[model samples]
Target: MRAPLLCALLLLAGLQACVQAFYLPGVAPQDFKRKDVIYLKVNKLSSIKNQLPYEYYSLPYCRPEKIVQSAENLGEVLRGDRIENSLYQIQMRVDEQCKVLCRIDALSGAQTKAFKAKIEDDYRVNMILDNLPVAMVKMRKDEKSNSLVKLYERGFPVGFTATTSGGQPEVKFFLHNHLRFTILYHKDEITDLARIVGFEVEPFSVKHTYETPWDKVSPTLNTCNPGRATFVTHDMPPQPVKEGEEVIFTYDVRFVASDIRWASRWDTYLLMIDDQIHWFSIINSVMIVLFLTGMVAMIIVRTLHRDITKYNQLESGEDAQEETGWKLVHGDVFRPPANASLLATFVGTGVQLFGMAMVTMLFALLGFLSPANRGGLMTAMLMMFVFMGLFAGYFSARLYKSFRGEEWKKTTMRTALLFPGVCFGIFFCLNILIWGQKSSGAVPFGTLFALCFLWFGISVPLVFIGSYFGYKKPAPEDPVRTNKIPRQIPDQPWYMNPVFSCLVGGVLPFGAVFIELFFILTSMWLHQFYYLFGFLTLVFIILLVTCAEITIVLCYFQLCSEDYHWWWRAYFTSGSSALYLFAYSAFYFYSKLDITKTVPMLMYFGYMSMISIGFFCLTGTMGFYACYIFVRQIYGAVKID
Candidate 1:
């Protein structure tokens, strides 16, 4: 079991290292450049009386490809409108519910040819669907289209899931990327209040009431009935209609982008308008950073200063062990960590990792870096780990000294490198598996080499430096001399065991992230967009706090239970958050994912292991530091000579 567990952990660590190394960038451009393009949509009309009244619901959107195409066409037009540009294309699918279109379906090839010819002559730049008063507008003719610009500016992920009743139930997922609306109505009713504001002419129908500068009613009405005595409209906005029990005017729109990075890839050619939601996320992120930074700073400075001062002022060479601080149970300080030895290693590794993560986040909040920089996380983490190695070395040396063990050298060596080595090995094994599958998700060989260089060139040396400092920090000044003979600990019930308390400490932090993990998985596997960085950052903060608090509570309980060997116990108590993370990952896979094969399963587990390593390190660090502080405070206040 130990061997298998070790192999599994090493494999996971290696894969995570690669992902951190190779994942591409996911960020918007820094500069604002506007590219415009027209948006068009078509629908079949049920009836076309003398002068058909149509209302269009116009919303701003951007499509990069369309914008690029428009730019190319405009370039050609400027040279000379000699070239007839094929500006738009539409492919309609008639599903089983559409019975009337079957006659045209039988002559599909002929109808398609005829439709193409008719569109070339009559439609020109944009197409007309069936015999509707609404004519799609050509907003711009450019290669890089700023069609989804509005949605992008809003920062709303341009996708929504629609549910409908079938034999069981059916879900239609729509990603709103490109489509826009145009309305056409009679000019005579344009100024009328009933016509502009729109009132029910019939139970299922509406008449326009007002006229606006952008509204044009004549040209639109002329397109449907050419020779009829009907006025045409140029541009009209889509109007919202609501009546008792009628679906008079409703059209579904969607955007189709070639790839996820459509906006930035095309640069000048295609740009999405800023969506309102995106603006909101930016504002929210700024506020959250300010709030969290302030709170964290206050706690660290005020509470820690008071606690440290109180610890240092206690009289020595007295009955200081009777005091209420953490040092009261000095004998119980070097206990083996809870759970398995493997878990203990992870917790130890996590302490260093936490410092790295906190620093990186703070730096990001300060605007020195943004997520848009591809490989930024990997670079930051690599640098952080190198610096953290010093902490690992120092902490390990101090703890080993406090244990008064003869094998301090061995302990320091293992503490400095063993856990990181294990994680790296795990990550490498998983990468091999990914490579075998020929998945795009796999890290390339070159990236792997870079990662190795980063680890050796940066992290390894830092670990040695850190260990030296840690060894130098002085074994926490024990206030009271240890008795020549060790004190015997009283046996406690199972509930009071380090194992049980560590197990309990994993719950709250895990709870905070379970739901969020579902969306993260969708982003990784299903290729859905996830722009909830603000939520994610908040959850990250909550997870840290919850893990720290729970671990502190458990550590205090174990200390009170007379377990002096808490060096490892404190590490594992919070480190157990990894188990919760792993469990949640499994639940998300089985319950939330629509995975169908062994490859995806393997991939999921492989990636999950990487995540587990990070959480393990983060939570473990929190517990260790908390316990370390508590133990030092108690010992510092005691009387020793």
Candidate 2:
């Protein structure tokens, strides 16, 4: 047990050292001279509704002569990111307007249907140039500015549906065929090196009127000609997407110099958005912590001290026997509850998850796991969880031994397999559903195999080794021996019932972090950036404190009620917060999102279920340990034989 803990500490230390000494840049910026070709990359077509991403070239859109896929990490693959070269060309520090790339005289029936379906689903085209994701600029009313202000939505929508004005409105599909790009760059004062900082595009649709006849090689357009160019305007009519209809692709790229530093260039693109809600969340959480702290302090300082003092003054064992409440049930208080195996496994898994979350947040806070690292954060989390298996097995084995369990092998296996197996099963089923939809969001078979290998190969071995040593290690000291026959818990009132108490106990912990949970979900599903790891870390610590304090309070009361079956109750009391988490997820789905598809809805619930389950383990473990310590100290200080 101590070995695994030492190894984990060492691993964490090394990781931190590596991050500080030799930090690897996720996407390094390159300085380009005048007229240098800057390659543009397209990521994928995404929609908030479906939540299923498709490869950008999946549709009959214009593509580069050679589509070269960019290298991706495990996280990127899991995220359904398919970054590839694009057809649109750009030159550093050069302006281009109304340059036509290709002309499609007629769209195939299949092409037309695909475009219409994508438009209906509200898909957005995500593009990347010089590491900055291109955003669609929209004008919105700003209260401070009496006029309209430009707002940057992360990705540009594919197209919109339109109805022509007539006696009977004719429904039609319009495509945004023209893009006006605004590339912001920063020039070094010393070296004159120019690095691209921001990329924003205004999408427009222009139904071109051609002046020169349709020639395979060259064509002149009255609406858009390179020599006498008519730049794309917002008021221009969108090109209709119908069978046997002509479509022209055009783009304009203009580069502007700025004084912003390369390091902070992402600040503008991160929000373009209020954080008073964040302040309120922090304050609310701090207040809850303080309240719980005060209650716990009162119990320790005023209540527990008096009880111990009075109990210590008892003349003999006969006087102690007359004592009521917790002192009467001291012998049974530390007895293991029903299904000790399950508790041990879940507690171990929870510790593993807790370690991963703490370290990941630390990395994010230190700026190592920036968005520029693409899939770095996810990859780090998965790796950390896998490596933390050592500690999981150690703790669970010790718990199993403490429960007087003999099947060390079986208990260790359960600790290694239970939580991850269930999570992986849910993920695999969801991946199959994604495959059925032909969505790129599905994890590849190779990646699935790798996940299995990590679980069975590396993680399983570490868990077994840790468990073997943990079983060899001595169990913790028990102040009093458990009676061979269990103590019968007295009939309790409705509010003191196990279920009711657990439910009530979970509320404060959930309340401490729901506001932050909302923001996390928004960032995950709504395609927004979340960089406030500091606030997240604070909330995380507060949540742990809340769970621990609340459980200790409830356990003290239960002991006072003379109910000795607190082992499972402590776990459930904190774990029930996952219930409210699922409830809030349902509420958020209906209220915050525009997802109308069946698969996406299923996905939302499925993913939320996994998160809730994980959270149950994390918080439950905190609570169990807290109660364990409280029981140990109180029982140890009392006169028990």
User: Best candidate per lDDT, number?
Assistant: 2
- The 0-to-1 C-alpha lDDT of every candidate, in the order given, reads 0.45, 0.85
lDDT of 1 by residue, 523-557 (tens): 55442334445556666776666655555556556
Which residue ranges in model 1 land beyond 4 Å of their true spot? 1-348, 367-372, 405-416, 515-519, 526-538, 638-641
457-566 per-residue lDDT for model 2 (tens digits): 76787788778888889999788887888788888877899999999999999999999999999988988888888889999999999999999999999999999989
How does candidate 1 score on lDDT? Answer: 0.45
lDDT of candidate 2 at residue 192, scale 0 to 100: 69
